[model samples]
Target: MDKKDRSILALLQTDAKLSISDIAERVNLSTTACWKRIQCLNEGGYLRQQVWLLNSKMLGLGVTVFMSIKTSHHDLQWLRKFALGVRDLPEVLEFYRMSGDTDYLLKIVAPDIAGFDRVYKKLIQIAELFDVSSSFAMEEIKYTTALPLDYTHTA
Candidate 1:
């Protein structure tokens, strides 16, 4: 990737709805060149799917829960089953296998405590968990889908 490629990515990250001509103008490239660059980026796996972000509060999903999970099962089969189960849950926005005291972490959004409890019940049935701890987010200080492009390698 070169400087112009990086600029194209930065522009797209800011607003995915920007037209090819708009991107080209901002990056000082021809419309065709910008369009080709974007295609290349997509083919190269640098660009992922684009989707609109909705307002959770307005959609009646005001509660955000960070759930820390601990489990004794480390076998691949158990992990596969657990991962599949968790991934199928629509409430789970983010799930990660972490190092340290927490075995796994899940970021879940729901309408309220009752909604979360329903998810919690389904979660416990998926696997034999050693411990499960949940913390509710009081405020979101910063949230963004855009990633930093400063570390991109240019040629």
Candidate 2:
């Protein structure tokens, strides 16, 4: 990753919809060169899948909740069942196996308190949890998908 490659990545991270010509101009590279570089970045797995971040309020999902789960079962089978149960739920936007007292954490989006309760009930029916706690966000102060590129190095 040279300076030109870094520049291209910075631009693309800001907006994946940018055209190859626009990226080329911003990075000061020829169109062909920029295209090939992007291809290399994709092949090398440095560039992952691009995604659009949606506005929660606009989509009728105004409530954001973080759920902390603690499970008594630590066996592989139990963990697999829990993972599958949560994975099938569309409301679960993010899931992580935590390292602290909580066994897992999930970020859920819903329309309101009733909607969140429905999701919670469905989740508990799938797998028995020792403890489940939810924290609702009053507002989304900041959010972003862009990754800092300063740590990347030219190979």
lDDT per residue for candidate 2 within 9-103, as digits (tens), equals 89888997899999998888999999999999899998888887788889999999999999999999998998999999999999999998999
Tens digits of per-residue lDDT, candidate 1, 35-74, equal 9999999999998888788899999999999999999999
Q: How much does candidate 1 score in TM-score?
A: 0.97
TM-score of every model?
0.97, 0.95
- Residue-pair clash count for candidate 2: 0
> How big is the RMSD of model 2?
1.2
Q: For model 1, state the Cα shift of residue 71 in Å.
A: 0.3
Q: How accurate locally, in lDDT, is each candidate?
A: 0.95, 0.92
lDDT of 1 at 109: 100
lDDT of 2 at 11: 89
Model 1 C-alpha lDDT versus the unseen true structure? 0.95
